[model samples]
Target: MLELLDLLWTFFKIGLFTFGGGYAMIPLITESVVAKGWLETSQLIDFIAISESTPGPFAINIATFVGFNQAGILGSIFATLGVVLPSFIIIVIVAKAFSKFATNKFVLGFLRGVKPVVVGIIFSVAVSFILQNVFSFSFKELGDFIFKWSTIIIFIVVFAMTRIWKKIHPIFIVLVSGIMGLIIYGLIL
Candidate 1:
């Protein structure tokens, strides 16, 4: 149907244009999906959190979540295909050519140039998420910014735990954070 193709094309463009990774692709994804009225910013945030926390590749999970939420199981298939196809094709082409051009100055320069852009995008996404969660900043408004005290408390505790315990694993931190969220937001506020 028209909707399925739209889903496929939207994510196809996203996957093709997305240079970095899931984090780097966040801004583009937000613009595309939110502009299309496919998902609200808050709902997209939830999908983002779910995608990050769950197992499997981040981009695929997010694409699938958006597709499923927008349509259904079939939509997930189309969207996932759209997102993966570009990379699959590009990697195949690059793998074939990269060896021959591995030492070429142009290729090397292009790769070098992309690294900083990717880092910047990821860094911006991190700061944006922190602002949204910790400072309650939203895309919809400029004023009425309020501090999220409970989230800030959780953030500080988790940050301190990470710094204090160098041996701690990331998965454990995520689990603890999730539990803390449940306790603070779900129960005691």
Candidate 2:
């Protein structure tokens, strides 16, 4: 159907243009999904959280969720296929020529240039997420920043935990955080 085709084309565009994967693709995915009226910003954020917490690649998880929400099982299939197809084809071609370009200065330079861009993209996404979840600004009154203290506290704790316990697995941190959320938001507040 036409709906399936549209889903395929839209996700195809998203997958083809995005680089660095997952977090880096957040802005693009958010914009496209919101513009298409598939999901609201808050819902997208929730979806992102769910996607990150679950298994598989973030981008693929998001595509599957969005597609399933829009149309159902077949929609999920089409959207997933559309998003993955470009990378599949590109990888196949690149693999064939990788040996030839492996020592090429141009390829090396291009990859080096991409590293900083990916970092910037991921940093921007992180900042946006912090702004949305942890800060509220009153721009009319000289841009006063109001903090969501609990979320800020949690962020600090998790950050410190990671830095302090480098050997600890992330799943443990996630589990602890969930328990903290339940205690803080459910029981305390």
TM-score of each: 0.85, 0.85
lDDT of 2: 0.80
Highest lDDT model number? 1
Off by over 4 Å in 2: 104-106, 137-144
lDDT of 2 by residue, 1-189 (tens): 999998898888888877776777777877787888988877887776677568888778888988999999998998898889889988898888888877799988987998799889889777766666667542224455667768788888887898999987656777777787888899988
Question: What does each candidate score in C-alpha RMSD?
Answer: 2.3, 2.8
- lDDT tens digits by residue: candidate 1, 1-189: 798899899999999878766777788888898889988777877776676567888779877988898789999999899999999998888887887678888988997998898898888877878778788886667756777779889999998999999898656787888899999999996
Among all windows of 10 consecutive residues in model 2, the one with the lowest summed lDDT is 136-145
Q: TM-score of the candidate numbered 2?
A: 0.85
- By summed lDDT, which 10 consecutive residues of candidate 1 come out lowest? 138-147
Native-structure RMSD, model 1: 2.3
